[model samples]
Target: MIGRIMKIVSRQYTLLGENGEKHDAILMGKVRRQDVPAAGDLAEAEYVNGRWVIQKILPRRNRLIRPSCANIDQALIVMSVKDPDFSPALVDRISMLIMKADITPVLIITKCDLGIPDETEEMIREYENGPMKVIRTAKDEASDEVAAILEGKISVLTGQSGAGKSTLLNTLEPSFHLATQEISKALGRGKHTTRHNELHSVAGGLVADTPGFSSLDFSHVSASELGSCVPDFIPYLGKCRFNDCIHQNEPGCAVKEAVESGSVPQRRYRNYLGVLEIIQNRKEKYL
Candidate 1:
C-alpha cells in the first residue's frame, strides 16, 4: 500500500494511509540505504509479516534543504514583525534556498499587533513587491485569506521559534493545539518548541510545522548562483561591467547603481550583502 509520511519521530515513521488510516512504518533495508524518506514523501509500504515497512520513496517535485522536507508546493517563510523582531538576513537566506529548489516562497509576516517599526515597514514593502507574495498576520484575527491560498497545496510554515508558526497553524486549524511559548526576554528570540517535522491536514491541504530555520544551512549555495536566486536582481544582473560581478565593490556594477538609484530597496541590498558574505566565507573554509 502507498501512503504519505506525516512525520518521523526517533526513526519511527507515521504515515497517513489511502483511506485516511494512520499507520506506523519503518524503512526497509534497500529503501533506507538508497533514499531517506522525508516528511512529505509519498511512499510505498508493505504489511509483510505484520509490519508496515516503507519499501520505496516516490520521486519528489521539489525538496527544501533546510528544515529538510520534500515534494513541497510552497514554503511559508514565517517571520515576526515585532516581538522577536524581524531578521531580513534570515528571510532572504531562506528565500534563496526555496527558490533554488523551485518551490514558491511566500513571506508570512507574523505579530503585527505589537506594531511595526518604520524601518521594518520599509523592508516589508520591498518584499511585498518582490518575487514572493507577502502576507501579514495579527495575533488575534482570521487567517481565511492565508488559509484560502494554502488550500489544496502542500505548504510548510517555518521561521524563528516564537515567530508564531505553531500559533498560526492552530489558528488555521483549531484542533491542532500545537504548543507555543513566549519569547525569552534575555535572548530576544523564541523558544524552540516545534521539535520535529510533521504534516498536518489544514485548510483542505497538508501544512507541516517545521522546527524553525534557526540553523538554516546555506553552505551549499554558491556565490555565483546567488544573483539568479534573487528575482529582483535579474533586471540589473548581467548589465554589470565585470562579467563575474557578485554585485559588491565591482566597478560599474549595475546592481550597486540600482541600489543607489532607488531601484532596489537598500535594506534588501544590505541583507543581500550579508548572505553573500556568508556563502563566500563558507566557500573559503572549504578551500
Candidate 2:
C-alpha cells in the first residue's frame, strides 16, 4: 500500500492510506539505515505478519532542510510585522531555498495589527509586486485568500519562532488549537513552540506546521546558482552583458542595473547580497 506519512513519533509512523484509511506502521530496518521518511512523504508500505512497515520513500518533488519535510507544493514564508520583528534577510533566505527546489513561495505577513514599520511597509509593497505573492493579515484576522490557496495542495509553514505559524493555523481553524508561545522579552525573539512536523487537514489541503527557523542551511545551493534563485532577478538574468554574471560587483550586470533603476526593491536586493555572501562563506569554509 502507498500511504502518506501523517506523522512520525517514537520511531512509529502514522500513515494515511490512499483510501483515507489510517495505519500505524514502522520503518523497515534496511530503509531506515538508507533513508528515513518525512512527515509529508508517500511511502511504499506492506502488511506482513499483521505489522505495516514502510519499505521505501517515493521520489520527492521538493524537500526543505530545516524542519525537514518533502514534496511541497508551496511554502508559506510567514513573517510578523512586530514582536519578533519583520526580517527581510530571513524571509529572502527561505524564499530562495523554496524557489531553488522548484516550489512556489508565498509570503504571508502576520501581526499587522502591531503596525508595520516604514521600512517593513516598503518591503511589503515590493514583495506584493515582486516575484512571489504576499498575503497580509493580522494575528487575529485569518485570511480567506490563504484558505482558498490551501485547497487540494500541500503547503508548509516556515518562518521565525514568534511569527505566529501555529497562531495563523489556529485562526484559520479553531480546532487545530496548536501550541503557541510568547516572545521572550530579554532575548528579543520567539521561543520554540512547535516540536515536530505534523500534517493537518484544512481547506481540503494538507498543511505542515514545522519548527520555525532562526538559522538556515545553504549547502544544497551554490554561489553562481544563487542569483537565478532570486525571483526578482529572473527577468534581468540572461540579459547581463557577461553570461557568468552573479549580479554582484559584476560589470554590465542587468540585475544590478535593475536594482539601481528601482525595478527590484533595494531592500530585497540587499538581502540577496547578504545571502550570497553567506553562501560564498559557507563554500569557502568547506574548501
Candidate 3:
C-alpha cells in the first residue's frame, strides 16, 4: 500500500497509511537500491516481519538541494532583529532562489521583542509589497502571528541557525524537540545545531526544519534568466529598450529607473546587480 512518509528517525520512518494508521517502517532493499526517502515523500510499502518496509518512493514535484526536501510548497525565510541581525540581501537571495524554483517565499521576522528597527520594517514592507508575504514573530510560544502565517502550507523554515529557526519551530509545535543553539559571542554568527532536513507535522500544515547554510550562491543560474528571478523586476522586464539589457548602466532601463522613482527598493536593485555580477562571472562555467 502507498503511504505518506512523515518522520524519518534514523533508519526507521513513521508512515501515515491511507487509512490514517501510523506505521513504523524501514527501507526495504528495493527502496534503498533506488533513491533515499525523505520525510515528505509518498512511498509504497508493505507490512512484513511485523513492521512496514518501504518498497518504492514516488516522484517529487520539486526538490531543494540545500534543504534536501522534495515537493515543497513554500519557504519561511526567518530573520532575527538582533543577535546576528537581519540581512536584507540574504532575504533577497533566498527569495530569488524560491522564485527560480517556482516556490512561494514567506518572509518571517523573528525576535520582534528587540524592537523592529526602521530598516528592517522597511525591508519587510518592500518584500510584502512584492510577491512575498511578510509577517512578524516573537520568541513567545503563544504568539499567533507566525502560526497564522504558516497555516495550511508545506513550508520550510530556513535562515541562519542563530536566527532562531528551530526556536520558532519549537514555539509553533512544542512537541518537536528540535535542538537549538545560542549565538556565538565572539564570531557573531549562529551556531548551527540542525544537521538535517526533518519535517514536522503542524496543525493544518507541515514545517521542515532545514539545515542552515552560511552562504547562498546563485551563480549556477544563467544571466538571461536572472532578471526574472527578481519578482519586482517582472513588471519592467520586456519594457527595456534592448532585449539583452542587464539593467546596469543601460540607457532607458525601466528597472533601474523604477528604483530611482521609488517603485522598486534600492536594496533590491543592488542585490540584483550583485547577483548579476555573480552570474556573469560564472557564465562560462555553467555553459
lDDT of each: 0.83, 0.84, 0.78
lDDT of 3 by residue, 98-193 (tens): 878777788888898889879777777887787667787777654576677567667787787678888887787877777777423444444577
Q: Which candidate wins on TM-score?
A: 2
The top-ranked prediction according to lDDT is 2
TM-score of each: 0.87, 0.90, 0.87
Cα displacement (Å) at residue 206, model 1 = 1.3
- Candidate 2 lDDT, 1-287, residue by residue in tens: 99998888879999988777899999998988988678889999999999998999999877765667788899899988888888788888888887887888899999999878898898788888887889998857878998999998889888988788889898999888787774334445445777677888887789999864446777788888998889888898899998888888889999989989999988888988888888888888889
Give the candidate order by descending lDDT.
2, 1, 3
In model 1, which residue pairs have backbone atoms overlapping below 3 Å? Answer: none
- Candidate 1 off by > 4 Å: 49-51, 182-190, 238-243
lDDT winner, 2 or 3: 2
1-287, model 1: which lDDT tens digit per residue?
98988888877999888787999998888888897778889999989898899989999887765566888998898999977789887888878777777777898999998889999998899888776788999986767879988898889887776788888988888787877774234445445777667889998888888754567677767888788777678789789998999998889999999889988878778878888898888888889
Q: Which stretches of candidate 3 lie over 4 Å from their true place?
A: 18-20, 182-190, 284-287
